[model samples]
Each structure stands twice: as structure tokens, then as C-alpha cells.
Target: MEVAMRKKIRRIITILGTTAMIFTVTACGNRMDTMQPAASYVADFFDIPDTVTGIERLLLKDDMAYLCCLEEDGTSYLAAMDIDDGKFLKQNLDLDASVSLLDFGFAPDNSNWAVCLEKAGGYSLRKFDNSGSQVQSVDLAGVMDSPVISAVGRDLFLSIDMEGNICVAAKGGNTLVYLFDNNGRFLFSLDYEGNLMTTTTTAEGKIGICATSSDRMNYDLLTVDMETQDWSKDKICLGATAGLYGGVNKDFYRFDSSVLYGYAAGAQEGIPVFNWSDMGLGTSEVQLGECTDGRFVVLTASSNQTEVLSYEMAVLTEGVDERELLSMVSLTATPGLVQAVSDFNKTNDRYKVELTEYFPYAQNVSNEEWDNAILNLNTRIISGDMPDILDMSNLSVQIYQSKGLLEDLYPYMENDPEIRTEDYFENVFEAISLDGKLPYLTDGVAISTMLAGADVVDGNNGWTIQDLEKVLDTYGANSINNLSGASFLKIMLQTDGSFIDWNLGKCSFDSPEFVKMLEFAGKIQESSQDGCGGTEMSDTYAEAYEEVLSV
Candidate 1:
């Protein structure tokens, strides 16, 4: 039944016109001036199908690009596109309810490919020829019998080497790399210490796995020869922390920010092959696959002004020009800021905002990865290599201000004729001011409010601590709705900002007024524990409101 449904889904073939944009990045002598446009490479952009919801993996086989795409109906299929003509073909594979597609890769010969699937009992490996026909299916439960497989969870990596040998790797508690022959026969498994960073297969049929030391300060690349069945480990120094982009012959690509670096199998250093910054492209969520012809296939998904995500496919070849880059760094990409930067670049020719996100959107971000990224950002700031603009949404602005790393924005606002002090809310500026100086500006503000019956406070819209105390005394604490200690404290903190004095760098938490508020909250908590507080209005308030209505 599953195979029949897969065959049914493969009956449809739709041809749509693809959108393409040719962009160039040029290099100038030994120094690449980011502000000036120089000659480098050309980029061709294409539109992905609207029905394709997500791309699990992208592979380039000769002139064709294959993508394992998930559709809106929650089914997975393979879509092939002719790179030159922009023609697309969709074919669904035999995936049932009991199994899920984990990862897929193509053989070096471009004549066949394979997918790794996770099932209830264990895992399965399915192989298919270039024509999309199944050639072999092997159950990997017995083959992957090591206890490390169960300990590593399910973060799996699959690839096919030059000699059509299959390699699968799992990373978590430890790193395990398994090698298998093309005939679905198990060969050998290599174990390595530390966390696995990435894995790649070179043209010489050698599988390379990069892992970080326990301290995370050192990196090592383990290379395994499929035929010889011998492996070697060597320390390597990379230009920047990067993820592997697979291998094209002897050279493999590593992606960091908007730059793509190419390195030989055993080389310590990699040279930049493509820089999306040179073409004024935002690197928010990008996936790259290298072609055999020295070109690249890039898949990028970005949110528009309406907050709708759109995907684009681009081909990067040798020839384009650079643009003036205004660099910006942030922990994650915010939709509004990304849209604003894209709009500014479209309208202005002199400058473009290059936003670099340390932690892009992911299902799960390990605590170690988050901490390392934060440390990296702090190191850059301390070394005076920070970007032109820093998104302080996820950062501590007060700490930066204390260190005198932030600049005062009040002077600039005062000199600008368009921005008048009277035009905006004065309190908004006062709220964030540090030491009587405005260091940052916000686009909008959120107001926290509490709603009450006008008759309860005699039509008064404002209330002080004395007024609150009088009301509580008159109606009893249970007359309020679910005003427990935790709720009361939350409301006070949200509605009041007087606790922290930004200008003086002090907090009034120890003051008598704050102490009194805490005591009042504690009384409410005790009442709640005694069964006097609830979600609904108490009988006292209900009876009083009924009497008023009768009058």
C-alpha cells in the first residue's frame, strides 16, 4: 500500500517558469575593500516551488540538482531540477507510516543515491539508482549493534564515497562512524573521542570526520580509507568555525556566515570561494551544495515584511562585484530587522546592511553551542572588532553602557531636523536613558494595563498604593480575582518600572515601599494557601455588585 501511494504521487509532473538573478562579486588586489565593488563571481537565483515546505537535503549530480523536499501534506519526496534549463521533476519514494527519512546523499559517480530511514525496531538503508528505482534495502539494526548508537540519540550523518561505499555517523555522548560496502555489506566502524562537528567524503574514497576536543579549543579531522580500512587523525586549524558543505572531488567546502571556504582533504587552511556579502545577499538561513564544475547551489529562506517565509535557490559561479557592506551582528535573525535591511539595500546603492546571526533558527540549540557563540561575540567586542551595529535585544545593554562600549544617540537625534524631541513620547526616551544619556532607541513600546469596573474605584483610572490598600480593606483580599502572591508580584513588576534607576545604576528593591509591597504580596499568598483566593470574584464583591444593581 505504501509503495502504491508513492507511485501515485509520482504521477504528477509540473513545469513552472523559474526566476533567475545574476549577481557578481569582484576581488581587488590583496585587500578586498568591502565598500568598493570589485570583480569576483556571478550568482544566479531561482525560485523554489510554492508547495515545497522544507528542504531536508540538497545534492548536485552533474547538471541536475536534487532536493529531498517535504510538502504541505506532510509527505516527503525527491525533486530534481535541471540547473541549466530550470526544469523541475518530482518523484515520491516508498516511505511508510512506520519509518521516517533521516538523511540522503548521492554517489560520486552520479549514477545512484541512497537514503537513511529510522524505524521502530532500528534503522533502514535504502538504495536507488539514478533512474529513481530501488536497487537494495538493508536493515541496519544488526549492523549498528554498538551501545554508542543508542547513547548518541538520533543525530545521524550519511554519505557515499567515490568508490560507492556508504558511511554513516552518529554524534552525541560519543562519535561513531560506520562504513559499508556498495553491496549492503558491513565493513568497519571507527570510534573517536569528543563531539563530532561535521563529516565529508572526498574523491579519493576517504571519509573525513571533524570533531572538537573536550575543551572545544582544539579540532581534529579523522580520515578513513574505505579500501585500506585504515584511519588517521590530525589536528586542523580552520579560518572560522564552520559546518561542512560536503566535498567536490579533492576539495571540500566549509560555510561560515556568508562566506564559503574551500579546503583540500588534509589542508589546515581554506580559501574563501564565495561570499554572499559581496552580492548584497542576507545570510539568515542558507544551505549550500557544491557542484562538480566549481559552481554552487544555494538554498535560502527569508521572511518578508509580512513575516511570510519565502525560499530561493541560487547558483554561484565565477564572476560578480562587491558592495559597501554595513555589518551588523545579532544572536538570532529578527524578521522586522531583516526586512528593514533588505528594503534599505534595495533602495540605496551606496550601502548595504550585512547581518550575521550567530544562532540561526534550529529545533534544538545545545547549551554549550549557545555559550560558545556568546563567548565568541564577547571576544570580538573586547578586541575592538565588533560590527558597525549590534542588536542588543538578546544582550545586556546596561553592561555594555557600564563598559563605555555604547555611544550616546541623543546628540544625533537632537541634530536631526526630522526627529524633534516634541514629536515622540518623552517618557519613552526617559525610561531607557542611562546616566542622563540615551544609548539606544526602540521602534515601539508595549503597555501593560489592568482592567477593572469603574464603580469599583468610583470611576478612577489611576491608583496608588494607599488606594489599593483602602480597596483591599473595604472588600477583603478574596474579592479580587486570583490575586495570589506570584500573580500580584508579576503584575507589579510589569506595570511599574520604578524599581531600577538606570541613570544612577541602582535598584530600589531594598527600599521601604518595595518591602511593603512584598509584605502585602506575602499576605495574599498566605490567604491563597488558606483557600480564600480563587479565579472567580469572591462572594463579598458579588453581593456588593448585586446590591448596587438593585438600587
Candidate 2:
């Protein structure tokens, strides 16, 4: 059997003004390290209002940037600025208790900008002219229960196609998108059972909104007839864009509903290849300024500052010597971690880390389902289709090490100047080390602490079993029943005796000391099972006994 050696590398890429980088990887060969800037427009900087505390929504139309900025007093104002010179033309419309700005765009050949504001279980479709004057306002009150429905105006899109002026705003949480005309007339709505990713126009000049199912796999473009308000669905040949948290791309050039359409190299091509590769050069929910003379502006804002990035769309559409390869990385997905990975990828184009999923629907999975997914992934690893990163937080590092699947990372850490052992939290190296060999690397450390109602024991520096027993006695018999299964296990481990001998991978649960721990567990179980001390259990002893036995 041939053992394949996998190299895990960590490299930092500097991003400043359209930097293009390349990294070549192949089996049994030298990896070329090259860095070059691409032929894209350089980034331009601008300053927003010093009092501007937060950005509620952003939109760009006809070379002008529209921003809904929240002031330090929590008041939102609609502001407009020139994309070319970053000059604030005008603003003063105050909108309070605003939830989200749904859709913002221009009417067909109209200079006025229409925006939908969500607030207090209602939808306010307001139109503002170039000078920020409110010309029209329509309120759809009682759309949802305010307290119950926290997220309003989650997705807002307006498209003016050959069909008619159409507006799409999320009515419910991943449930529906209400449609309307340019005059704030409620046309119709489509029952969309997914999170809206983006809105694009079909080549035939039709309006379409791209959405992903709850599983984040189904990418469906829901189109609506602007004339008749009729809705239709066509499945696009691409995996769902990583919602708002995940950076998404625009699909601007596809007309035929029968043909597969995807964004490749900044152009819509007839390809259905599901590229889970991350270019890192992308955006979340951003405002695209008017495209004029083959160039466009990207406006992005945070709480304190705003930035404008100019780009030559034509240059982007054309091929450059640099290539952005999508590097696939598999990890247990969480919002914070996903955003972190997204930010890291955007830092440099040399390597884009795309996260692969063990299952199509990773969220809201049962423990049994998660176990099965891991089992399936382990089988894949056995067949040599291992992911670049294992994300051992969700899997057993010991099992991988025992199977000779995990490589020792100590040498890599030692040789890499970027990584320093002293920078990590105490005991991390010892905890992740197996047989004097490091097998796992965690992004961060989790500190464990105990919460007690009124201290009864000296547990500050750590206490012994006798100290714990005194604490329990002080709290009385009811405390034992309140202890969860995990708490019971922790106490036993902290008290004394080892469950497993790491070298032999064998547990010593049958030993006399282990029996004492089991007896303590039984005492608590009996109290709860017998309905003593105001505690009750269906089958406490059986459940508790099985928990210990499994360990």
C-alpha cells in the first residue's frame, strides 16, 4: 500500500489594489510561488459622515451612490453621492425604527429612486427624487407580526426589464417575496421557500430573483412577468451562493430558460459546473454603481467608514495572465467561521479556500444524522478522497491518528516562522498532541468554567473529590439530581482515575475506583428516579448507567 503524503501550508497574501497572485501545486513536483497584480481598476477611498454610525442599506444608480446611514442617535437618513468624485450631493429624509431597506432602484427612464423600507410589521415603499425629496409613499401595514418576525426586508431587489418595472421585497422569513410596480401598486407575490441570493435580468429583458433553498443546495431563479404579474421558476445550474454571509456573484447574461447559466470569469457562460472554489475576490451584499463607458464603481460601507472600488468591467470580462484557482477546504460551517474564511480568501488571490460540505444540508441536522455524515466522510477518506482540511473539531482526532490517517504537524509548526507555539493558549499543544505528535490545529481555544449558585467549595485553583463531596453535601441531595450526564462525567474525571490509557486505547471502567464513580452516579439516579427532593426521571438509572458504560 502506498501512503500519500499531504502537505499542509499556511501562506499570507497581501491585498492592495487588484493584486493578482498564483500558486501552482502538483504531485511530486516543485510548487511555483508567484505574485503579480491583475489588470483591474485600482481601489479608491472616500470618507463618509463622521457622525455616520452604521449603514442600513446601500444602492448605486446612474453614477450616484445612495446610502441609508444610521446616525449616532439611531436615526436613518437617505443620502446620495457622486460615484466619480465621492461628493455628497444631498440627504435629509429621516426614517426611524427602520428594519431593512428592501429594494432600491430607478424607474424606466425615470430620474427618481424607489426604495422599500421595512419597519414595525409593515412595508413602506417610498420614492425619492435626485434631491432626496419624497415624491410617493405606500405603506403595506400588518404584513407580519413585529415581535414574532424579527427579520424584515431581508432581501430587496428592483429590476426594470423589457417586461415592466418590477420590485421584489422579502415579505416573510425565507417564505415569500412581494411584488409591486414602480408606482407602489401591489402587483402580486411569489411563494419562494428559500433565502433570496440576488436579483438579475434575463437576456430577453425579463426580471428574475435568484434564491437558494434552506439546504443551501437548490439554486432557483424565480422569474415574474411584469405585465401580468405571473411568476415562473427555472432551476439554474449552480449551487446556491453562500447567502448574505457568504460572498455572492452577479449573473447578468442569461436569457433562455432552457439553457444552463453560470458566472465564470466574471461573465455568464453556459456551464453548470458546481465550482465550490472561492476566489476570495467577491462581495457580500454590496452596491454596484452605474456601469458606464465599460467601467463601474463598487460602494461598500461599515459603521464608521465607506470605500469605493472602481473597476473596468470590460477588463474583468477579458482574460488576464493571472488565474484565480478555487482551493477547496472542508470544515464544520458556522456563521462566524464562514465569514472568517471568506475574509481570509479575499485577502489574496494566490489561494481561495472554498469549504466543502459533508452533507447538502449541514444546518439543523440531528446528532444521528451528523454521526452518519461523519461515518460517510471517514469512508471517503479511506478511499483516498480526503479534503484539504479535516476540521477535527467535529471529528475524533484520536480515531484518525489511530488509523494512521493524520500527519504530525509539529515539524510544520516548527519550520514555519509565521506560527509560534507561545502564541497559542496554554495546554493546547498538550491537548491536541497524540503520542508526542500533533495531529490537529484549532482556530481558537474554548475555556471551560463552572457556574455555581453561591460558592460552597474551594474550587478556585481546583478541588479534590472530597471537596466536591462537601460541596454536594452543603447543597443537599437535590443538587445531584440536577447534575446532567455531562456534568456527572466531568466530576468523575476530575475526582480521580483515568478512563482510557492513551497508549493502549483501552478503558479501565471495570476497576474498583471506577465502580465508586458509578455508585455515586447511581445514588443521584435513584434520587431522581424515586421522585425524591422534588426530582423525577422516566428511567434515570438505566440512562445514567448506559452513559457510563458507553464511556
Candidate 3:
């Protein structure tokens, strides 16, 4: 039945919506005086077909763009496009039910290609040598139970390192990666814990698998040693796999969120040495074009269209020069804070900081009205509308950190003569460190502790959040009324399950721990028949909310 379905779907069917962009990076010599445009148009008004309801997967290989789409009738189609001239190629296939393209990569011989297709409950390997013809096909249903098949998404990934070996990563059963040669022969499979985000090859013949967890809270970069079948894993501090782009050189350059991380790709120990950092705030959330000759193009999506941006990047050998005049810009919703900075600017001659008010709508608006205002602020920041030295209160540290936007302040603190790290409390300092390095500065600290009645919960005895939950689970809904919002929030803050990490700049507020906190709070609200009987704490927290709650 499966082979019949595959034959039935593998026809010359072009089911619409195919678009492509060809991006090339250019290397330029230093004149530094000529202004460089951050981005420019490679192509415009280019899009998929009108009939295509949704895009299931997008892949770029050998300057060609392949997209899998699902029609309104629940059927799937694979479309190909020429990235150079926005030309639609003559290859489209109707995919069987529950079958979709996972990933595609160049075969070892460079003359053929392989595509990973997921069927109802299995996978298949398809080879195309004519660029429009499938030369061979094989079913992977039995192998789908292997640990390498345990991925979390419908999309699979195929990549080749410098040595021309192939890597296929999938995410449904258990996020696993399989190694192979150019001949469609399986090498071996390895158990990978996270969603396969990207695969990189070093200057040598090393394959790097970059994967992340479902919640975007954990990440791993693994390198496989083929001959010995040895693999090593490196934990990535960045939380989400979103907005990550990079290519290999002498090292692998990864652009995550807003920062560029240079990982020494040739390490045998699997841990890539952090070489350099790029503070290109302008590159935030922009999809990188192909890396060529030290220049690259970026595509940014807005509204219903795509905008292109170009850049001239310096490679590892480029020299640097110090600037005389330093200018910084910031966007903020707080007027008083802006005015304070303006006052300082008036007195200082060495530096001039310009502040732009982000949300005028935030003024004279209720708390409910500020929701969209905050979203707007986030959109602007991600679009490279950033100011140096941003205030974190209005911005998301996790989002920025995941993008490599926020600078690690530990090095800065060490160099500054006047700033003493010891001045801050230990826990407060630790709170701001994600990977054990200070990425941001906090003005003060907020503490969370439990507040429960002697009759409601057992002896305090330094009861943790887990203990409180266990007690609640043992009792009925009546116990929830005794807990307040402040108390619940405090418990989350104190709990190890609070997934927000400032250093990494990622937060899983929707994590199980946070959900439990909200569920408890919801029970309290739900049990209040009149919604007026629950005790509410509404006073200025002079000392600490945790201290007050505990008392």
C-alpha cells in the first residue's frame, strides 16, 4: 500500500506557491569612510503560490529552494525554484498522506542529491541525480524505530561536511541523527536529545549537529568521529533554535539572535572554543544570505512581504581601528528615564547618547493597553531598530540573549576601575548570569519565598516549591484559596524549575514549573465563589516580598 501510494504521488505535478532568493556575500577592503547599506533588494514581490494554504518546510541546496506545501484538501506538494532568477523549476511531486519532505542535501558525489521524506509512520530516502529525476528510493520504516529517528518535528535535515559525508537528522520519535556517505549507505545512528536545527562541517571532515529542546530552553552542539564512532556533545547557552544562521570557514560562524559566535570547528574534544563575538545589532532576526567573499545578504519578513538587506562582513584576518567619536542610540517607553539621560548628555562632552521614545501610546493608557505597546517595542528591536546600552526592563532579556543581542558584562566589569562586582549581592549577581557570566546589570533584586498558614501546610522547615505542590495535591481545592497570586509567583521565583536564564537570554515561562504555579493560582481564583473572599496583598514592598510572605 505504501509503495503504491508513493508511485501514485510521484508524478509531474506542479501544485503552485514556489519562490526563491539567491544571496551572495561580498568581501570588501577597508575604506570604512564609505557608508554601507545594512540591507538591499535582491528581489521583491517574490512569493509562493496563491493556492498554497501553508508552507510545511523550506530548504536551500545548491542554489535551489525547495518548499513543501499542504493544499486546502490536506494533500501535500513539493515545489522547487531557481534561487538566482526566481524561476520555477519543472519538478513538483504530490506527496502521500502523512508524507512530507524532511530535508534535502547534496549527495557525496556532488552529482546527485538525497531527500528525506517522512511517510505515515516511517521515512524514505530518495536520490535524484538528474536534478529532476529520482534515480533510486528506499523505505526506512523499520529503521524509523532507531534512536536516530527520535526527532520532534516533521522536517528532517541533510548536510555534508568538508569530507563529503552526509548527515540526516529527524525529530518525531526521539530526535536522532544518522550519518551516511554520498552513496545513500547508512553509516551509523546516534541519539540526539534536541530538535535538529542545523548541521555544519568544519574546514576538515567533521560534522557538527546543532540541536535544541522543544521548549527552546536547552541546546546541544555535537561532533561525530566517524572512524571510531565517537561523538561529543557541547551544551549551547542560547535557548531557542530560532533566528540561528551560520556557515563554516577556518571556524564555524554562528549568528544567533543579535550576536555572532565563532566556534573553533576543528576541535577533537567536541567542545568548540569561543573565539570572537560580533556585536552586529543590525543583524538581529535577519536570515543570512549565502556567505561569499566576505559579504552576505539578509532577508527580513514584515507584514505580508519580504525586505532584503546587504552587508560587507570582515573575515578573521581583518584589522580594526579605534574610533574617536562614539554615538549610541536607545529606544525607551519611560520618559523620565530618557529625560535623565538627556540631562547627563548636556553635561558630558566625551559621549552623546540619543534616546528615542518607543511607545507614545503607552502614555495615558491602562495596563491592558500596554500589551500591544510592548509587542511593538519587541518588533522594532528584532528588526535592528536597536539602541546601544538598552534598558532591559522594557525589553526581553531572554529574546535578546538568544539572538546574541545583550553583551556579556563580566569582561567589562573586570576592566572598569570604578565598578566593583563585590558591591552587588551574590544571589542577585548570579541571577543575571546565564552561562555563569554576567550579561546584564540589575539595579536591585527580587526574592521569592512561600507564605502558608500553619494549619494549611506542614512545618515550614525550609519547604521548597515541590513540597508546597505535594501538600496542595494531597488536599482539596479549598486549600488553594489560602494561596495568593503574590505567594504563587514567589514560589516560582524560588523554584529551580523557573526556566528564565538572563545570561542565555531565554525564558520558558510556559515551562511545567510555571504552569504549575499558574494552575495553583487559577484554582485559588476558581474556588472563590464571590471573587471577593480571597485575601489580597496590596502594599508597597519596603523590605522584601519573600520576607513579608514568610512572616
**Which one wins on lDDT?**
1
Residue-wise lDDT of candidate 3 within 165-191, one digit each (tens)?
777766654457777766667778887
Error of 3 at 300 (Å): 5.5
The runs of at least 3 residues in candidate 3 whose Cα sits more than 4 Å from the true structure, single-residue gaps closed, are: 1-99, 111-120, 146-155, 162-164, 172-174, 193-195, 201-205, 212-218, 232-251, 260-264, 267-289, 295-551
Alpha-carbon local distance difference test for all models: 0.60, 0.46, 0.46
Best TM-score among the predictions, by candidate number: 2
lDDT of 2 by residue, 356-454 (tens): 544322233445666677777666666776555454544445566777766678887899999888976536566546689877655543322223433
Q: Write the per-residue lDDT of candidate 1 for residues 331-379, one digit (tens) a residue.
A: 6544444445555654566776665666532212455666787888888
lDDT measured at residue 78 in model 2 versus the true structure, 0 to 100 = 64
Residue 435 in model 2: shift from native, Å?
2.0
Greater-TM-score candidate between 1 and 2: 2
What is residue 106's positional error in candidate 2, in angstroms?
1.9
Count of residue pairs whose backbone atoms collide, per candidate: 14, 1, 25
RMSD of each: 13.3, 11.0, 19.7
Query: Of the candidates numbered 1 and 2, which has the greater lDDT value?
Result: 1
